[model samples]
Target: MLALPKPVKRAIAGPPVRRDGQQLDLDIQLLLRLLTPRRPQPVPPPEQMRAGQSFVDRVVAGPEEPGVRREDRTVPGAVADLRARLYVPPPGPDVVDGALLVYVHGGGFVAGDLDTHDELCATLAAESGARVLSVDYRLAPEHPFPAAVDDCLAAFAHVTAHPVEFGAAPGRIAVGGDSAGASLALTVARETSRDGADPAGRPVFCLAFFPVTALDGHTRSRELFGDGFLLTGEAIEAMAGWYVPEAMRDDPRLRIAEGDLSGMPPAYVATAGFDPLRDEGEHLVTRMREAGVPATLRRHPDLVHGFATSLGIGVRPRQAVAEAAGALRTAFALLGAT
Candidate 1:
C-alpha cells in the first residue's frame, strides 16, 4: 500500500485516544490523522471531481486479493452505458449456486468509481464465493438525483434478467454498498418492492455498511462524531445538496428512513461507532424489523466511517467484511434450500 502523505503521517504519531465514549481503534485513529488536517474540496468543476476521486483512491486502494478473477464491462444504463467491474472467485465447492452481489461504491454520491473500490469488491467475491459486480453509477452535480438511482435499477434488472449472461443463478441476487452506495441499494430495494413490475426479480438480501439513511443530519451520531471522523457534517451536507434537488431533499427515495420498508428483503446493516451516519443506519434496520422485515445489525464500536474500505490497514475491517460475506452466503444457501 502507498504511504499516507507526510503531514498525515505526522498527525498519527501520538497515543490512541477515545471519542464519544468509544475507544478509537488504532487503525481508525491513524486514518483520521491522515484525513483530518486536509479537507477535501467540494466536487463540482471537472477538475475538483477528479481530484476528489484521486484522493479517495489513494486512501482506500489496496492490493487485490488472490483467488478472484476480475473483468470490466459495460451495462445498459437509463441514459448511457454504465461501466461495471465484475469479480468472480476461483472455482470451489463452497461457491454458492451462481449467486451475484451487485455492489455500489461510496463517494457521497459525488466521487469514487470502479477503480477506487476494486479491491473491496475482489475481497467480497473471494470471501463470499459469489460473483460481485461493482457499479459505476452516475455522480451528482452533473447527473444529479434519480440519475444514479435509475442506473442502479436498470443495472439490477439487466443482471437479474440475464443471469446466465453474468454467470449468476436465476433468482439468487443481492445488493450491497457503503455510505451513499448503501443508501442507493436501499432505495433500489424499495422501488423494486413497490413496483412489483419486475416479474423476473428482486434482491434477495441487502448488506449496507454505514448507510446514509436520511438526509436530515440532526441525529445524535451526526452531532457527536460529525467533525473528526473523516466524514464531517459539512462534507455530508455539501454532498447531499449536490446530489439531491432542493425541493426533493425529503423524498423517500433519497431519505430512505422515512420510506415504507415493509416488503423489503432481509437486510444486514453494519455501523461504525464513530461514524456520523451510525444512528441513521442503525435506525433503518430497527424500522425494518418493526415492519416485520427480517434485519440484523452489527455495530463496530471502535471503528469510524469507511472502516470497511481500510481493510489493508487492520484486521477489524477484513473481519467485518468476512462476517458480512458469510451472512450473504448463508442467505443464499437458505434461499437455494427453500
Candidate 2:
C-alpha cells in the first residue's frame, strides 16, 4: 500500500472544530475530538451507570508509574466493608514524616469507583509525594443519603487511626476529592472539626476541585454553562435526586453552602469557569475565608467540569493537577512548621 504524505495525514487528523459560541480550552477541544462520537441515548439508570463506567474504563489510563506502589484493601465501613486503594510513593531524601491524602472519587454520587480514579490517584501520589488513599464509598439511589457519607467518614476514621500502617505520619493527614467527592471531603472535615475530634484524627487541610457546594441550580454559571458543558443541569438534578432525599437536600451537612465553615480546615478550592458548579465552589471558598478559615481559590476560565479527570488527554489538566499537588505539599509543609 502506498503511504500518504505526512502533511495530508496531519490535515486529516486535525483537532476538532470548536463549537459555535463556545470558549473551551484547546486541549479540551482536542480531547473531545478524540472521543467516540455518539448520539444521546436515554438508557435506564442502571444501564446508564454501567455504560458510564465502561466509558471511563476505556478513556482513563491505567497505572504506569513504577515509583508509586498501589494496593487494594477492604476497609471497615459504618454499615459494611468498603473497597479502597492506597497509593504510596517511594520515600524521598527530604522526606521526614510524609502526609496521607484520603481521596474520594467523583461520579456525581451515582457512578465512579476505585478503578475509574486509579490513574488519577497514582498520579497524585507520585506528584505530591504523599500516600493517597482512594475510597470506594457506596453510591446513591441504592445506598442513598448518609450511606456514602457514613462510609467516607468511616474510611477517614480508619485511616486516621492507622496512618502508621499506611506509612504516613499520624497527625499529617489531608482530605480531598473532585465533584461529589469534594463535597464529601469538606463535610468530613467540617464534622471532624466541629466535634473537637482528636488532633491526630483531624485533617490538616482540604482540597476541592469543582465541587458541588449547594444543590440549588440558579447560579449564573449554571445558566451559562449548564447545558453545553459536560455536566448539564438535568444531570446534576438527577444525581442530587439519587443521592439525597428532597427533605434533606438543605441540610447543612449535605449543603456546604449553608454549613458552618468556622474551625474547618484550611482549604484549596479549584473551579473551572465553564462548570455549572463554579459559582458554588467559589462561594464556598469565599464563605470559608470570611469565617476566618484560611482558604484559596483557583479558577480555570477556559476549562469545563470534570477537567481534573482528563489528566491523560492534555497539558492544561495535568498542569492543574500538578498545581493542586504543589498546593498540597505546601499545606503539609505548613502543618509540619506548626
Candidate 3:
C-alpha cells in the first residue's frame, strides 16, 4: 500500500482531541481544520465541486490495495447505461463462496464516481474477502432524485440475476455503500426485502457507512458538528438543491428515515463521531431494529464524515472501514451467502 507524505502522517500522529466523552481522530481534526474556513462558506458549483473532490481524492487516497483485481463493465440502469467496477480480493481461505457486495459510491448525490472510491472499494473486498460490485450511478443536475436510486437498483438487479457473469456465486448477494450511496444501498435492501417480498429476491445484508437518511430531521448531531467536519450543512443544502426539487423533497424515498423499515435483511450501519449525517444514520439503525430487523450501529467517535474514503490515509480510517468490512464478511457467511 502507498503511504502519505512523511510530514502529513507525522502531523496526524500528534496529540489526541477529546470532547463530549468522545475523542476526535487527529487526522480529521487537522486536515479538515486546515481546509475549513473560519466562517462557513458556500461550496462551489457542481462541476467545480466534482473537480475539487476528484483532485483531493487523488492527493489523499494513496493507492488501491495490491493483489485485488479490478474489472470495469457497463451495467443496465433505469435511466441510462451505468459504469461499474468489480473487485475480487486476494485468494484466501476466508473468502466466501458465491457471495458478493453491491456497493454504491457517495458524493452527496453529485460528485463521486468509480475512481474516487477506488481504493475504498478495494479495501472492502480485501478485508472482507468477498467480491464487490461498485456502481457509478448518474449524478445530480444532469440526473436528479430517483436517477441515482434507479441506477443502483438496476445494477443490483443485474448482478443478482447474473451472478456468474459478474464472477460471483449464485444467491449470495449483499448491498453496501457510504454516505449518499449508503442511502441508496439501504433503499435497495428495504425495497427488495420488505413485507410480502419474495425470499429469493431479497438481499442477505446491508452495509452502510455514515449514511445520509434524512435532511429535515435537524438532529442534535447536525447542530453540533454540521460545520468544520469536512461535510457541512451548507454543502448539504446546496447538493440537495441540485439533486432534489423543493416540491419533491418530502418524498419518502429521498427522506428514507420516514419510510417503512420493516421486513428488511439484517444490517450493519456505521457512523462517524462528527458528521452532520451521524444522527440520521444512527436513527436508521434504531428504527430498523425497532422494526424487527437485526441491526447494529457502530459509532467511530474519533472520526468525521467521509472517513471511509480515506481508508489508505489515516490509521483510524482504515481500521474503522475494516471493522465494517469484517461485519459484512461475517454477515454473508452467517446468512448462508457462503
Candidate 4:
C-alpha cells in the first residue's frame, strides 16, 4: 500500500501515467507510510536504531558477491583523523582508471555514518565506475556546527590533496553526500573555489543529493513536508539547532548557498518532490546557473528526501542509486571536457 499525503494524492489523482516511466511510486508513497507516525510502535533505545540499521546493512547490503570489493579505512581530514570506508570494484587495474567519489553520510548533522551508507556506496562504486570513499564525519549535538563543517572540509582536503594515497586520479575527483552531507559537499566546493589553491589549480565538481541548502527555515517545502513526511519541521529545527549555532548561521563557510556561487565547479543537484529541503536544493541549482556555473537539476516527483540513501532495501533504492551514479558520470564527463 502506498501512503501518500493529501497534496501528493491530489497531484497524482488525474494521471496514471508516470513521468519518468516509473510504474510504481514506492519512493514517495512508502515514505509517506514511514512518516505517518504509527502510534510509536515499541520505541527502542538509540543504540537499537544503530543495531537495526546495521542489521539492514548486513541483510540488504550483504557481503560482497562477485564484482564488488569493499574495505574500511580512515584518512586524516579537517577534524582529527576522520573515519572512512573505501569501496572499490573488482579488478585492480580498473581501480586506478575509475573516478573517485568522496561521500559524506546524511543524518541531518546528527546521526548516520559509513555503516548506514554502506550499500549506497557499493552501488555507487559499481554503477558510476568510480571508487567511493564514505566519510564518517563527527555528528552534531556534540560536535556542533563548525565541527561537522570542519570535519567535512578536512575530508575533502585530504582526498583532493592526496588522491593517489586513496588510489584516485586527482584530476577526476568529486565530492557529494545526502542531506546534511550534501550541504557539506556544496560548502566544500564553495570554500575550495574561494581559495583558488588547488593541487593543480582546478575546481572540484559536486553532486548534491537532496541537500538541505538553507537552515533559515523559510522555504515552502520546509513548511509543507514539515510534518507527516518522515521529517517534521520540529525535527528539522531541532537538527538545525543542534548542528548550527544562531550566531553563525549566515557564515558562508557554514551556509554554502547563502553566499556567492561564482567560479564554483559544475554541479548536479537532486530534489525530492515532498522533501522539506526540496526548494532549497532547487534554489541553489538556480543560483548556480544564474552565476553561470554549469548546473543540472532533477526532481523525482514521486520521491521524498533520503530516498537515495534508503534505496538499498526497497526496489526503488537501486533506481535511486543509479540516478545518482548517472549524475556523477555526467558531471565527470562534463568536467573532463573542460
Cα lDDT, all candidates: 0.83, 0.80, 0.84, 0.72
- Residues 173-196, candidate 1, lDDT per residue (tens digit)? 899999999999988887887755
- Candidate 2, lDDT over the whole model: 0.80
lDDT of 3: 0.84
Highest lDDT scorer? 3
TM-score of each: 0.92, 0.89, 0.93, 0.83
Give per-residue CA lDDT, model 2, range 120-193, as digits (tens). 78778878878899999988889888898899999899989988877788888999999999999999999888
Which lDDT value does model 4 have at 295?
89
Worst lDDT run of 10 residues, candidate 1, spans: 1-10
Question: lDDT by residue for model 4 over 1-338, one digit each (tens)?
Answer: 23455556646433332433333354345445444555744433335544654554454453443587777888876647988998886775434364788888887777788877887788788777778899888877778878887888777777777788777876788888888889887887887776545644243678888888777758877876665556567767767777787888777776566667888888888887767888888988988998889988988766666776665434555676688788787666666677
10 residues in a row with least lDDT, candidate 4:
15-24
For every candidate in turn, the CA RMSD to the true structure comes to 3.1, 3.6, 2.7, 5.2
lDDT score for residue 289 of model 3: 82
Better candidate by lDDT, 2 or 4: 2
